[model samples]
Target: MKNKLPLYLLLFFLIIVNAFFLYNYLGAGDQGGPKDQIRPGDFLVKELGLDATQQAAFRTLGREHHRKMRGLLDDIKELKDALFKGLSDDPSHQVNVDSIVHLIGEKEAAKDLEVFRHFKKVQALCNAKQKEKFAKIIEDGLRVGGRDQGPRGARPEGERGPRSKGFEDNRPPRPNGPNANRPPPAARE
Candidate 1:
């Protein structure tokens, strides 16, 4: 009976551990639901104080915009793939890199245009006060060195001054240091 006691205790401990793990695994599934999840554009909807109809229209617009953007992105990816694949081709059959790059740029431009049009459509949906708010939002977004202008080394208007050491000016200093007025020896070759 004494030897069997340890076996029974071990079985009980394992059952408890298994039950805990099972409970945790099953419990995690219940934590997520449509109501708990924040969907894209929800913030805009809330900020704009859109009516049900407006919200529906906005969602429809978003879906259409996303579909178009996806198509454009896929096209861009295909172009990029062709561009890279051209690297392996025979010298005589080399792809026109510039044309492919131009096409990629055009696709990117179209994406930007699509986004602009989308926002314009959203602006059209707004009432007077909402439109004002939307305009302010857009204005802030477009402002130079604004919140949207992420860490690309762009400083706010007043922060601009004479070039300082350790500041990133987007151009690296010449290898010969600050006093290097002449071109490198390699360039002379």
Candidate 2:
């Protein structure tokens, strides 16, 4: 009976801890649904304040857009696989690899165009006030890191300050020292 008492106490403690965890975990959303489950079109209904009719249209548009995007994305994945597989074997397959990369780029451009069209449809459904808010949302989404970082993030390759080049090493090369230009260490060893 004493042995059983300890086991019963341990089980009771575990049950209490599990109930506490489940309560907090489920309560985190406050939206009364599973934490991991996402309702795909809920953002339009909730964030954009879409009416029932608009929500239905948005959902339909979203579904069709996603279906088209899925095909493009899958083709991109397949082309990427073929390109990498070429890399693992023949150096002579460079032409084929380049062709695969071009196809992937085309598919990506199509997917991006589809997204732009989808958002344009969404914007059309917005009211004057909602359209203002929607414009802000799109603007914020497009900005790099949510704000223009200016030259710090936007400088072109050769236009970056001289010290920013990969070979700069931030130190003057030793004059005729052991590390001096001896074919850049590639031919030494």
What is the C-alpha lDDT profile of model 2 across 30-53, one tens digit per residue? 876677765746855677788888
- Kindly give the stretch of ten consecutive residues in candidate 1 with the minimal lDDT sum: 171-180
lDDT of 2 at 25: 81
**Residue 154, model 2, lDDT:** 47
Give model 1's TM-score versus the native structure. Answer: 0.57
In model 1, how large is the Cα lDDT of residue 186? 68
Which pairs of residues collide in model 1? Answer: none
Give candidate 1 misplaced runs (Cα > 4 Å).
1-37, 90-95, 142-189
- The C-alpha stretches of model 2 lying farther than 4 A from their native spots are 1-40, 144-147, 151-189
> What is each predicted model's overall lDDT from 0 to 1?
0.82, 0.78
